[model samples]
Every structure is written in structure tokens, then in C-alpha cells.
Target: MTNRAAGLLLFALISFAAPLQGQQAPAEAAQAAADQLEAATVALEAAESARDRVKALTGTVRAYEAGLGAMREGLRRVARRESQLLTQLKSREDDVAELLGILQTIETSAPPVLMLHPSGPLGAARSAMMVAEVTPGLYARAEALRRDLEEVQTLRLLQQNAAGTLEKGLSGVQEARTALSAAIADRTDLPRRFTENSVRTAILISSTETLTGFASGLAEIAGGAEKITPLSVDISAQRGELDLPVEGLLLRGFEKRDAAGIARPGLLIAARPRALVSTPTAATIRYRGPLLDLGNVVILEPQPDTLFILSGLAEVYGSAGQVIPAGTPVGLMGGSAPQAGAILSLSGEGGGTDRTETLYIEVRMDNSPVDPATWFRIGKGG
Candidate 1:
């Protein structure tokens, strides 16, 4: 290659090196996820008793979900980086081939002939200096290109092996969920604020056509007007500071109309199938059952006059009038969790959030519907 061509190639190679520095981030994220998964595995193994098994298993499931999510993000970044490397390499194909030929010629040429330029002795000396200057750069560039190729191979292998890891993670989470469910069923230590009168509850459900009407009659659903001790926990002081009941994307804001043009005074969240739904604060379960057309519901009274209604659950936990602590698992969202192969396929598609189930949250104060956003601190997926 001519001196100018060699100089241009060196510049391109140096420019390419800068981007390689960014590649480490994805690998670091993958390593962190692997570490998280290992910790979750250890926790799962340590859980032996039914007493704390529910909490342990819940942590395990959350850890696995976080690790799997991180891994998927890392894989996505790896795929993008690999594509960028391939494109860069392809665009410089001719330059690379010329560089290889030049290196080969230099290696095979006689020392005396390599020193002799066709122009003259002065030209030959300058050519010798140029060769000395450019040879090392060419080799260095070739080494960088080799490393890039290796990285592509490494990324491809990582993706291929990820399927197994994801499968194991999926299986682990499912087992944890099953174990948690069994543990919750066997639990009998939680304090009950009052007993739900099934007869009265049924009558209330039959009489009420809307959630507002049903919530208004929750007090009458108890067996009798027992003078129950009020809860000490105050949720009014926690406005705009409570975490969401589940990890999910905020689909529709409060009172945001859907395609059907019907708007409701609630927040709709898009969550992954079978995702854990927990209470954001210590509250009394006013009701826990199917209500109207909103599927299964869990109504929590965190204070005297305030109610937090969570709808769209597939499996409800805790009995009506039970006092549960904050972060206690209340239910699981509907739909089956995606299989490992399906998860891998979805990751490959570069899709947005993989949420398939929806949770509707409504807040009520003194029997009046209010925006849930005023109470929950909603983020990207929480």
C-alpha cells in the first residue's frame, strides 16, 4: 500500500479502538447477573423450613428475575456491539487485505532490496524510515482486528449458552413460586382484624354493579359491626412515596381513556405474567375476592378513611380483614410465564417490556375515587 493509504488505515484502526472500550460494559453486566444468580441459588438451597421459606423463596424468585433481566439486556448490548464490529470490519475489508499483502511482502523481501527505493538513495532512505514507522502500526491494527473477531465469536458463544442459563433461571423461579404458594397456604399466624361474613359479602357483591359502590359497602361486609381496634399504621403520610404493588410498566395514567373511550379513576400497569404482587404498605385486607367485571381484587385499608384497591390478580392471598405487613405478597398476576425458548426469541426480537398481564390500581378516600399516582411512586417498571 502507498504511504498515504497506510496512514489512513492507521487512523481508521485507532478510531476503531475507542469503541472497543465500550464493549466491556455489556460483559460486566453479564458477570454481575451471573453473580446475582449464584447468590439466589445459595439462598434457595438454605431455605429448609416452612416458617421463613415463603420470604426466602420470594427473594430467590426476585433475584432470579433481576438476573435474567440483566442477562437479557447484556445479550442485547452484545448483539448490537457485534453487529457494529462486523459492519466496521466489512467496510474496511479492502484496506485490511492490502495491509496483509504489504506485511507479507515486507516479511518475504530481501533486506537490501527493501532498503532500495526505485527513486534513488535519498528516496530509498525515506522509504526505509516510512516502513519502520508504518510496520509496527500495521501489526498493531491487525492485532486489534483479530481481537475484534475473537470478541464476535465470544459474544456469539455467550448468546448460544444463554439459553441454558435462562432455562435454569425460569425453572428456578417457577419452583420458588410454587413453594411460596404452598407456604402461604400453610401460614396461620397472621392476625385478623375481623372475619369476613361470606353471606354479607355475597349480598354486597350481588348488589353492587360498580367498584365504587362495592367499596362503599365494605364496612357492612363483616359478620357484625364489631368494635375492632383501628390500625396504627398511617398511609396518609406516605403519599407519593410508596412503591408499586408489582414490577411493571405504567400503561395508562389515572383517568386515561383507552381505545374504547372509557376512562376510569385508576392506574393500569403492565406486568409480566405470574409476577409477584405485594402490598406497598402495612394495611388491613378489607376484601379479597372476585368483584364485578374486574376479576380478582385485593382491597387494603391503610388508614381509617383511605383504601387502596388492586385489581386483575389471578390468585389472591390473605383473608378479608387480615392485617398484612408491607411488602407481603398479596397475589400473582394472571397468565403463564414465558418459556425459556420464548424468552430467548423475544430477546432476539429487540422488543420493549415483556409484560403480558395488567394490574389496575385505584385509590379511594372517604368513598371517593382518587388518582393512584398521588400515592404510589411509579417509575419505569415498578
Candidate 2:
């Protein structure tokens, strides 16, 4: 190869390999996920005898979900990086072959013959210097190619072995969910603000046509029963700072119109199937069950006049009168969890949406609808 050609080839090789140096490898992300999964497994074991098993199991399930999410992202990145490396190698095929030929010829040629040039000793000396300068670059390029190939192989193996890890994680999360449900059912420690009168609640549900009207009659649902002291938890300072009740993507902002062009004073969150929905703040369940056209609903009273309405749940928990703590699981979003194979395939496909379930959240202050985004932080968790 001419001096110019050698310089250009080395520059191209260096450029191709440069990005790999500073960028974080997929293995680090995958390893972090593995660590998270291991911690969740330990938490799950500890939850069995925990004083508050519901809380313990909830954390365990969330940890598992987070780990699985990270693992999926890591795999997607691995696939993309591998594809990029392959394309770069394929595009430089001719250059690489030429480089190899030049290196081989230089290695095989006797030193005496290499030193003899057509233009005598001066020309020969210059040619020798050029060869010496280019040889190191050629070896470096070869080493870079070798590393890329090894990385591709490693990524493929990681993907292959990921299925078993994913399966275990899915199973573990499901078990934690089941255990959490049982724990919640057995929980009787929560104080009741007032016992719900089923007869009155049913009558109110039948009479109301809109959420506004339904919420207006919420107090009457308790009938003439004596009321216990309300929860002392104050959430005024938490406005615009509370985490979302669920992990999801913000599908629609406050009052954003839907497909039908109807606007509502709430936020729409798109979540994965059967994702856990919890309370962002300590609150009493004002109502819990099917209402209007919405799915299973849980209306919470965080203060005297402020209410948080969460709808579209597949399974609702807690009674209307019970006061639950923050991060308490109230229900689960509808739909079946994706199978392990499906999840792995989706990750490989990359950037495909698996958030099939939607959760509608509304915040009502002084019995008037307000944007939920004002009260809860957006874009974090959900």
C-alpha cells in the first residue's frame, strides 16, 4: 500500500474503534440488572416472616420489575451495537483484505531485498521508515477487529442465556404479587374512617350519571354511621413532588383529548399488563368498585376536600373506609402479563411498545376537577 493509502486506512480503523472506548458496554448494564434481581430474590425470602409482609413483598415485586426492565434494555442495546459492528466490518472488507496482504508481504520479504529500492539507498531508507510507521497501525486495526468479533459472540451468548434469567424473574415477581395479595387480605391493622353502607353506596351508584355527581354523594355512602377521626397525614407540601402511583408512560397529559375528541380533567398513563398500582400518599378509600362506564375505581381522600381517583384497574383492593399508607397497593392494571419468550422477542425487536394497559388518574379538590399533573410529578416512574 502507498503511504497515503496506509494513513487513510489507519485513520478509518481508528475512527471505527474509537466509539467503543468511551461508551458503556452492555455487559455492565446486564450485570447491574443481575445484581438487582439477586437482591429482589433475597427480599422475597425475607418477606415471608416480615412484620409487614405486604410492604416487603411490594418492594420485592417492584425490584424484580425494575431489574427485568433493565435487562431487556441491555439486550436491545447489545443487539444494536452488534449490528453496528457487523456493518462497519462488512463495509471495510476490501480495505481490511488489502491491509492484511500488505502486512503479510512485508513480513515474508527478506530484509536485504526490502532495503533495496529502485531509487537506491535514500529511497529504500524512506520506504523502510514508512513500513515501520504503518506496521503498528495495521496490528492495532487487527486487534480492534478481533475485539469486535469477540464482543459480538459475547453479546449473542448473553442474549441466549437471558431467557432463563428472565423466566426466573417473571416467576419470582408473580410469586411476590400473589404473596402481597394474601398479605393484604390478612391485614386488619388499618383504621377505618367510617364503615361503608353497601345499600346507600349501591343506591348512589345507580342514581349518579357522571363522576362529578358520583363524587358529590360520596359522603352519603357511609349512611348515618358514626365516623372515626380522619387520617392526620397532610400532603399539601407534596404537591408536584409525589411519585406517580404506577410505573408507565404518560400517554395523555391533563385534559388532553382522546380519539373521540372528548376531554377530561385527568392524566392517562400507559402501563404494562398487570402492573401494580399504589397510593402516592396516605389516604382513606372513599370508594372502591365499578362505577359509571369506567373500570374498577378507587377514590381516595388524601385530605378533607382533596380526592384522588384512579380507574381502569382489573382488580381493586381495600375497603371504602380503610386508611392505607403511601405506596400501598390498591389494585392491578388489566391484561395478562407477557410470557418470557414474548418479552425476549420484543426486546430483541427494540423500541416496540408493550404498554397495553391504561390507567386514568384524576385529582378533585373541593369536589371540583383539577389536573392530576399539578399534584403528582410527571415523567418519573410514570
Candidate 3:
């Protein structure tokens, strides 16, 4: 072959060569992974226990929702592995025929017959040189096959684990949905602070200037000193212990810059569509309506002076001035579950609405924006 052709052929052969083998993860990465898995497992177990003990469906609903949130990290791990496994499987499939041919030749060839077939010294020398060239390729092919088999076994185990996880997640979601419906039905007689007129709400949405401005106006109209009772777990004391309102990857941290390069004083959570959002603490709904930039907004007061502003909802469930218990259903993010045969696309920083449902959470004390990362157990969505 010409030098260029030989180089190309060698490159093709190397493409199917044995992958450099080592521990699947580095020590640090593995440790971090273990920690995350442990956290997810703990959350799952807690949710299951809570669901079983709950006397009302409402409590079960919250537990189930929390379980789904916990499952997200595990699912994300599976998805990441799934991509890697696919690439490895494709490479092995591509090289299967070639590797089989090499194995067959090695298995059938007899050394004595090959040595006798070379009639002269020159012939033998040529044969030796040819043998020398082929030996390394044979070794490489054998190594590749061995690695491929090992990889296949690993992939099989991962697939089995993932299947079980997925089944549990699906079951949990179904039960949660059913329980939520029952809970809503049971609470049909619950009194509202004041009913919102759809016409006025729509008009307000159309006339709003900024999300913050609209929310500030609503707070003024709601008027008077805050009346909501304090939660049993003090907000300050529960720092870094607060649950996220929704299950999602933390796309943007407090004061992190967005796609427009503008830094915001809130967390942007990227979640799956229609993911249920629950209150992290007991709070009276200060405002629940749409804003100009934000799709739908719910401002809550966990304490008299502490405001939790949660925006980017597709549907708002609570009403203005209505007190909600901790873990109460607040609203929902836009989007449906990963549809059958549809791709589950992940998002990066500044995730858009098309692929991922994004929620914005901002905390304020005495009406000044504060970092929410300090208060919540922040983690990247699985």
C-alpha cells in the first residue's frame, strides 16, 4: 500500500483495537458517585416509609413526589452510562466479523504444515517476515475480543439495574398521581382566602411590566403585615436542609449569569415537564399569577419577613393569601414525561423550555434578594 493508504488502514485497525482498560472511574469520581447514590437510596427509602405510614393520601403524595425526585439522580447516572454503553456496543458490533475471521485463522492453522510448505531458505525468510508482521495484529485482535467480552458483561449488569430502577420509578409516579387525585377530592371543601377572577388575572398579566414589579404590586394589594404562622423547623436553622420545590438539575445557581450573560439572584432549576412542585416549608401564598417574563409565579412567605418567590410555573395551584402546609403541592412546571419513542434530551446551563422545564426560585428577607443555595440541599439533577 502507499504510505497514505497504509496509514489509513492502520488507523482503521486501531479503531477496533482493545480499549485501554482500567477501573471504570477514578477514585475521586467514584467516591463522589457513591455519595450521590447513597443520598438517592436514602431518599428513596424515606419516601417509601413515609408513604406507608401516612394516614392521608396528601402525605403519601408528597412522599411519592419526593421519591421521584430522588430517582432523578439515579436515572441521570443510568442515562450517562447508557450513552457510553451504546458507543462501546457500536464499536464491538463493527469489529465482530473481522475479529471472528482472525480467531478462525488462528484456531485452524497448523504450525508444522506451514513450516514444511516453505521450500527454500528465501521462502522461509519471507514467511518468517510475514509471520512477524501478522503476530502483533493477532495479539491486538485477541486483546480487543477479551475487552469486548468484559464490556458486554458490565453493560448487561447496568442494563438490568437500570430496568429495575425505571420500573420502580414508573410505579411510584403512578401511585403518587392516584393518591394526589384522591387528596384533592378529599380537600374539596377547603376554604379559599379569596377567589381570583380569571378576567382580572388575565388583564393583570397583559399589563405587567416586569415579573418582580408585578409580584411587588401583588404583595402591596394583599396588604398589611404578614399573617402566616412560622414553620416548626426555623428557616434559618434549616439552612442546607430545605428540600427543593421540584426535582431537577440545578441549571443556574444564585447570582449565576444566564445565557444573556446577566447574573440573577436566584436558582434556575431545569426539570422534566409537568413535574410537581411542592412547598419546601409551611407558607402563606402571597401571590399566584402570571408575570410578563415569567410564565406563572407563586410568591410564598415561610416566615413573616421571609419571602420565597418561585416563578416559571406552567400551572399555579395555590391562591393568594392561602396558607399552605409544608410539602403542600404548589404548582407544576411545563412539560410532559419523556414520551414513548421520544428522546430524553438533557440541558446545559441556561436550559430552554423546549427540552427541559425550568423553574426560578428566589428568596428574600425583608424584601431584599438573598442566596437560596444556603437554604436548600442543592444537587444536579440525575
TM-score of each: 0.93, 0.94, 0.58
Candidate with top lDDT is 2
Q: CA lDDT, every prediction?
A: 0.81, 0.84, 0.60
**Which of the predicted structures, 1 or 3, would earn the higher lDDT when compared with the native?**
1
Per-residue lDDT of model 3, residues 1-382, tens digit only: 1233234334446765556454343222323433444444444445544533223444544444444433343334445554565676676674555555544654676865445433566665656565557557756765765665665566446444444444554555556555554454345433444444556556556677865555555533433434333444456788789999987788889888888999999999887776778889887777777666767888887876778889998877756757677878777677665521222233111223333788999988776788998888898554
lDDT tens digits, residue span 1-382, model 1 = 3466557656655654644556667656766776777777777777655357777777777887787677767767777777788998999898777767778888898888777766778877877777778677767877888888888888788778778777777777787788778888887888998899999999999998999899888888778865556797676778999999998889899989999999999999998888899999889999998999999999999888889999999999889988888888899998988877776666544634578799999999999999898899988862
Candidate 3 lDDT for residue 262: 96
Tens-digit lDDT string for candidate 2 (199-291): 999999999999999998888888686554666767899899888888888889888999999998999998888789999989999999999
For TM-score, the strongest prediction is 2
Number of colliding residue pairs in each model: 0, 0, 3
Backbone clash total for model 2 is 0
Query: Candidate 1: which stretches are off by over 4 Å?
Result: 1-15, 226-228
Off by over 4 Å in 2: 1-19, 116-120, 226-229, 349-352, 380-382
Where model 3 places Cα greater than 4 Å from the true spot, the runs are 1-106, 109-175, 178-182, 188-233, 255-264, 291-293, 320-323, 344-355
